[model samples]
Target: MHFKVSNNGTAAVLEPYISMGGHAALLKNDRSVFVHLHPIGTISMASQEKFQENYTQGVLDREDICFFGFADDSTGNYFNSNTSPNGEVNFPAIKLTTPGNYSIWVQVKSAGEVITQKFDFNVIL
Candidate 1:
């Protein structure tokens, strides 16, 4: 799942998502599965940065992309949104481990205010 956070209905202010490290949390109603996601993927910022650094340093080549858990073609250009009139922050995909009801809290800070939007979904196999 992905979220497109915009400002004043048109401009997508995604700095918070980046500055906050793309913090998105999920909780199953039965409390069976939980995961924290970043803009790049379901990985910690430290590790993500490390992998990014390695990629830039040439220590890791394109062929070695699979070595990093957070590297994915789908998200390779996740942060490049300059072409879009509204900036956008794309969240990583969320896969439910078990079939059940789940609640997602998509929190983002815009103009110094932290906004939280709650969404519920039922997963069925």
Candidate 2:
């Protein structure tokens, strides 16, 4: 839901789910994510279902986490990931592999219906 940037470091929120349905997307109008970046240094990303006590604004309710890459080798699908059943993507950390165009998405639904949020970005590795 937020990206923290500083001389200290760059931190992003990422979910482990293979789809774009989660709490981060549920809280705001912006559904998708796109980034054009070549990491200047080490980066850390996470999907936080429950924010730590020090976090003033906290997470709502959830308990699943996932992180995925490139829906397919094709460009049309738009690489993305999100949270699962409990609105929580269950992973806490990820190690950098490679870099290129990247996409991030979050989704949420209610009353048997569904909604989707997505975004795309580039990693200039």
Candidate 3:
């Protein structure tokens, strides 16, 4: 999932651009589970950079999960340096402890405007 910053109602028209540094994400599940994520994902920018460096150096001990590869290319495709961008915002994978409906709110400032989007989903075994 890759989010392309754009103005209201129009997508192809990419917003001039801004840093994702101050973006925020809030997720709630029936008031039971809640989490706040930074623009970099679930961790701070420093932490994300550390992991990226480690991966680049091949210092990770486990091979099950890799959090390294997010790059924007000339084709406006952001991928794992190989995969293609699909226009869906990529959020950190989440684990729900219980089964219920959840709502996610993502807030970001793009082109001097604060944009917020709400998404709802269901969790089932």
Residue-level lDDT tens digits of model 1 in 1-125: 55666767776454444444346678999888887765546666698789779989988654433211223422233334212223444565766768989988876655556667788999999
Please report, as a residue range, the 10-residue window in candidate 1 with the lowest summed lDDT.
Answer: 66-75
Write down the worst ten-residue block by lDDT for model 2.
34-43
lDDT tens digits by residue: candidate 2, 5-49: 122343223332223323232111242432322111112334222
Candidate achieving the largest lDDT:
1
Question: lDDT of all the models against the reference?
Answer: 0.58, 0.31, 0.48
Instruction: State residue 7's C-alpha deviation in candidate 1, in Å.
Output: 5.3
Model 3: per-residue lDDT, tens digit, 24-53?
A: 444555486777754335666698678779
lDDT of 2 at 28: 18
TM-score of 1: 0.61
For model 1, the superposed segments whose C-alpha errors exceed 4 Å read 6-8, 17-21, 44-87
What's the number of clashes in each of the models? Answer: 0, 22, 3
